[model samples]
Every structure is written in C-alpha cells, then in structure tokens.
Target: MAPRSRNASAPTKPLLKAPAQIGSLDAAALVGELRQLHEDAEDPDIERMPSDNELYGALLYAEKHAKALAMKQGTEAAQRSAAVKRVLLWEYLREQTDLHQAKAIEDARAVKAEWADLAPVLAVSTPNAAYNKAKRLQAARLIDTAHGDRRLRRTPEAVVEAERRIAAQALAERRAEEQARQRHQLVLPVAQRLLGHRDGLAFDTDAEDWLDEMAAVVDDCHTSTQQVSLARYLGATVRALARLERQTGKPPATTEAARLAYSAAVELLSR
Candidate 1:
C-alpha cells in the first residue's frame, strides 16, 4: 500500500431515492393503482397475461387498500341486511311461544347466515368483523331472553335469574335500537345503473325485484332464477344494453323491447 488508491472504495450513493417523486405515492395510492390494474386485466379485451414481476408488484401494492374497501362494503351490507333481520327478530320476540315466531326467527337466522357469509368478503378490516360479531351476539342475547323458558313463578332462584336476564335484554335492545337509528339516518342512493331507471323514475321496486333474485342465488346457486340468479346477471344485462346503445351498434327496437328481453330472461330463470 505504498500509494493509496485514488478510489479505494466506490463512492457511496444514497440508499434511498429522492423524496420528490415518491411524495405523490403514499402507500394507499400504490395499492389502489395495483388493484385497478388487476381488475382491468379481468376484462375480456385483455388478451395477454401481465409479467410475473408486474403481478407480484401489483399484489404487494394491493394489501394496504384491501381493508378500507372491504370493510366499508361489508359494513354497509351488514347494516342493510341487519335492518331487515332485526325487524324480523322484533316481530319474533313479540310473538314468542307462538309457532309463527319460531318460523320467522328461522327465516331471519337464514338471512343472518347470508350476512355472515358475505361479511368476510366485504369487511374493511378485522375490527369490522369484531363490530358485526358483537352486534350479532347482542341480538342473540335478546332472542334468548325472549325465549328463555325458565319457570320464574315457581322458584325464587328462577325469579332472580329471569330478572337479571330481563335487565340484560333491556340494555341490549337499547343498543341495537340506537345502532338501527344511526344506520337509518345514513341513506345512500342505490346505484342508478343497477336499478334500470331511464331519466329517473321510481326504479326502486324494480331494483328490489332484481335484488331479491340475487338473494335467491345466494340462498340456492343450484337453482337459477329468471329474476336474479347471479350477481353477474344484472351486470351482464346492463352492459349488453349499453353495447346496444353504442352509435355504431344496432339498438333495441324500443325501450319496451329491451325491457321485455330482460324481464323474459329473468322470469324464465326464476321459474
């Protein structure tokens, strides 16, 4: 080492890149872009698969965005389904010791099962799951209270237990009612495209009919409905009509003609 080397070691470069370009991309932005790309690839027009590196990068980016979307959708769906479920539960509670109450509760239980099935797909995060689970647990407690068949009149012990149960039930009912009120106040417009409204008339009933068909699909996939066999069914109809309306494409003879086609297809499947 008689003469020290001019460049004994390579010049050290900053390990991190400059913050300017990266500033626009917070973690959430990166994830959302990746998801959009992934969803875009599902289109029929996309012929070739993206490279493995691209796919991997997209997946890594998507993780952060997952909880926000999943939880929001899950929560909204849960609240909507719960609105119907709770109403049914209330009716059942009032009719306890009556056979119809049992039947109605069974129906609500089925709806609740669907709510459970869908929640995981839509939940924003684990905390969303916890919240819904707690709500369900509270509802269960109320049902149990209304149906608790302990002979309170026969013994002091039974009487005390029944009173305690009543107190707990009262508290739960209040909480559930409050939740329902909060949810009730939040009225979101249903997707206009999904409802089949032209220039805005009351398409809510039509949408409900369509949704009922969707619910049936969840209830029984083996059976197809003219009404709504699959979630994709409505999506397909909407897309087809849009294509028909394209300037270069042939349009349906009339709006009535398009309606007939949609209605006929749904009715045939529903049967």
Candidate 2:
C-alpha cells in the first residue's frame, strides 16, 4: 500500500441546543442573549452585530408593548378606585343630605308653627291700619274727655305740648309697627332660601374634594364642562358674603351670609 492516506476521518456534526430559558436572569441581559442566539442560529457567517434599524424596531416593539401593558394596568386600577370611592361617597352624600334636609325642614316647620301661633295674637294687638287709626281716634277722644272733666285744669302751654307729644308718639308707634310687619314678611322668603341652601350644603360635603373627577361617571347633577361646579359657586358665595358684609355692616355669620353659603354649596353639589 503506497503510503496509505494518513487518516481520512469523517467529521462529526455538532448538536444545536435550544435557546436558553434565562428566567432568573435580568430581562435586559436575557434579551441580549436571546438576540445573540437568534443571530447564531440564523446566520453565523455575519461578523458584525445586527443592524441599527433591526435593534430599533425591536426596541420600539418592546416599548409599545410595555406602554400598552402599563396603560391597561393603570386603567384597571383607576377604575377600581373610582368605583370604591363612588360607593362610599354616594352613601356619605345620601346620609348627609338627608340628615340636613330633615333638620332644615323640621326647623322650618317649627318656625311656621310659631308664626301661626303668634298670628292671632299679633292681629289682636295691632289689627289693620284702619283699625289702628280707629283706636288712635278713640284714645284721643278719651284724653279730650279727661281734660274737660279734670279737677285741675291744664295750662295752655302744657295742653298744647301734651297734644303735640301724643301725636308724635302715635306716629312713631305706627311707623314702627309697619316696619316690624315688613321685617316679618322679609324673614319668610329668607327662611325659605336658607332651607334650600342647607340642603345643598349637605349634599356637597361628601364630594367637594373629588367632585370634578367623580362627575365624569356620576350624574346626580349636571356640571359645567363636566368639572366640579360647586367649587366656583363656593368661592363666589364667599366673595358675595364678604361684599354683603361690607355693604350691610354685618359679618359673615349673619343669616344672609349663611344662607348664601348654603345656596352656593347646594348649587355646586347638585350640579
């Protein structure tokens, strides 16, 4: 045998392994390793790394997927929070409104009852303008009779002064009575407004903090621009009260101020 070929041995083929699991590894490192394995399996002949455009596409896909997942999770969380808050606030507002409304109604009823009870007494005491005039005429006649029958006659100066004083006092008393009647009438409308305000204020107390956000899905009341309407009204009421205080020489604790505040709160809450 001429020099037998030293060794013509067959080459053994290398076995390919599956991609790594890398579950415990950092995601960034794992992704890098996965890309290397992909390149090796696909084309080991390429010397340079993958193209920038390919890496950019991968990154964009990953970013988009991440953003989508985050958005989904965030939305789910927000919805849960809103649902819970709505339930809690609904109960709170209901209780608050009902309680305040009941109290207001009770108070109003009491005032009405008191007024009713006093009406006859007032009518009996003051009567009408015509009756009041008659009473004055009767009193003047009695005084004149007394003057004529007096044991001691009155001097001219004293009599004239007394007559003038009596006329002045009667006029003053009549004006005072009219003013009191007017004030009483004014109180009725004011009381009604106050009751309305109290109802509204109670409603607003529950959601004043989150009304704007809650208003989107909750539609108990209409809102301007789907935002918290009460906030503006509350502020406006405060300013209005302040102005009233300045103009009327009264403080914010006055019934009118309280009523305005109540109205503002109610308008906002209802909206």
Candidate 3:
C-alpha cells in the first residue's frame, strides 16, 4: 500500500513557547514580550487565530511573574509597573485584534460606555489592571467626541486620583456602617426600657402613640445626634409622668412597678 499522505490541513505547532521563567524578566521586558505574542496571535490571514486559552494563560503567567518582581520593589513601583502592563495590553487588543477594524472599534466603544458598570467586576481579577483598562478606554472614547471635538484625555495622575477616591469612598462607607452598628447597640436597650415604661404606665390611649414614637426614634438611632435627642425627650417625658404619679399616689399594687419604670428611664438617659 502507498504510504499515507501528510495532512496538509493539520494545524501547525505554536510559533512561540512559554517562557521557562517569566518572573526573571523585568516589567518592561515582560510587557514587550507580551506585545510580540499578541502580534503573532493576530494573524488575520489565518482561518483560526491563536488559541484564546493559550493567550490568556500567557497573560496570567506574565501577570503573576510581574507581581513577584513588584514584591521586591516598593508598592508604588509595583503598582506603576502593573499599570503599564495593563495599558499595553489594552492598546494591543484595540490595535491588533483579528476582528475587523469596525468591529474592534465598536467593541471598544461598548466597553467605554459601560466602564463604570464593568470596573468593580473587573477589579475582582486585578485592581491595577481594571483601573488602567478603564483609564485607557476612557481616553480612547475622549479621542472622538461629538461634533468632531476631541476632549483632553485623562492624565495618569487623574487615573490615580480616581482610584484613590474609590478607595476613600469605600473606607467612608465602612466607617458609617460601624458607627450605625454602635448606635443601634446603644439605643436597643434604651428602646426596650421605654417600651417597658409604656407597659407600666397603662395609659390605654397614649400607649399606642408612645409606642409609635419610640419606634420612630429607634429607627432614627442610626445617627448619634438623633439618638441623643430621642433619649432626652424620652427621659423628660418619663420624669414628668413619674412626678404626676407621685403627686396622685400610685395604687399599692403598682407603686414598685412605677418606681422600676422611672429608674429604667433614668438609666437610659444617663447612658
């Protein structure tokens, strides 16, 4: 039998190899290597472009390697290096993707339009990468504004400041939450004491109103100033009621009950 013919349609071996030690390269060299790999992958004439999984693997490897290099440098230096890599990657995807130019531009515009929505999700992978990608996409969008007017692109400083603002906002939210939690803890016992006093007073008509007011005050205890106001008002009201009871003389069966309610209200105010 004749020898089997070679399969001319078979895929060729990859032109590039994974680096033995991607971590050995400095940030600049690693970025350059990535650009080269991306260019090779974007051969438009090929029926099938380079494997996306392989490209992603290479990117992940380079990122991890860059991070290792950054650990030895200061944090600021590492952040700058990561930013550079992310910007380069975004630029590569914009310019050298196998997609038609119009499709690529459309995709980029879509990303720009939804950047605010996309940022937090992207940040789950790498904060520096997400920030840099958002900045570059915004800059690209600014290049062509309405009426052929090109806006000034954001500076690196602006991007860094934006990131700082996001971080600061996150911190402020956390502090607010902690403060609210503390206020709730402080107000809960006072609210319970006030409810007990309502029970002891036994004013059928006023009990519902008092309970509603107490509920409103408890709801507003998220703020320290509001808590203080509620506490003072409740204390004053309780004291007035206690004075009235003393003047009128509580029934023997309810004298101790009135005293306990008055004592609780006093303690709630002191706290």
Best-matching candidate per TM-score = 3
| Cand. 1 Cα-lDDT | 0.39
Residue 159 miss distance in model 2 (angstroms): 2.1
- Model 2, 4-83: lDDT tens digits are 66753222111123222212323344335434433433423323443433433444333333223224323455334434
lDDT of 1 by residue, 1-271 (tens): 5976584332121112221111112333433443444344342322232333453343433332333333433344433443443344334433332334334434655676454544454343464463344343333223223334311122223334445677887899777666544432221111222243332222334444544454444334332222123535454444454444464355432456445544444443343
Q: Rank the candidates by lDDT, best first.
A: 3, 2, 1
Worst 10 contiguous positions by lDDT, candidate 2: 12-21
CA displacement after TM-score superposition, residue 95 of candidate 3 (Å): 18
In order of appearance, the predictions have TM-scores of 0.21, 0.21, 0.31
What shift in Å separates residue 88 of candidate 3 from its native position after superposition?
30
Cα RMSD (angstroms) for every candidate in the order listed: 30.2, 43.8, 21.2
lDDT of each: 0.39, 0.39, 0.49
**lDDT value for model 3:** 0.49
Q: For residues 140-253, could you state the per-residue lDDT of candidate 3 as single tens digits?
A: 333222213333234434334444555787799888767656755765676666566554563433434545666677655656666555655565565555555566676212
Candidate 3 local Cα displacement, residue 3, angstroms: 81
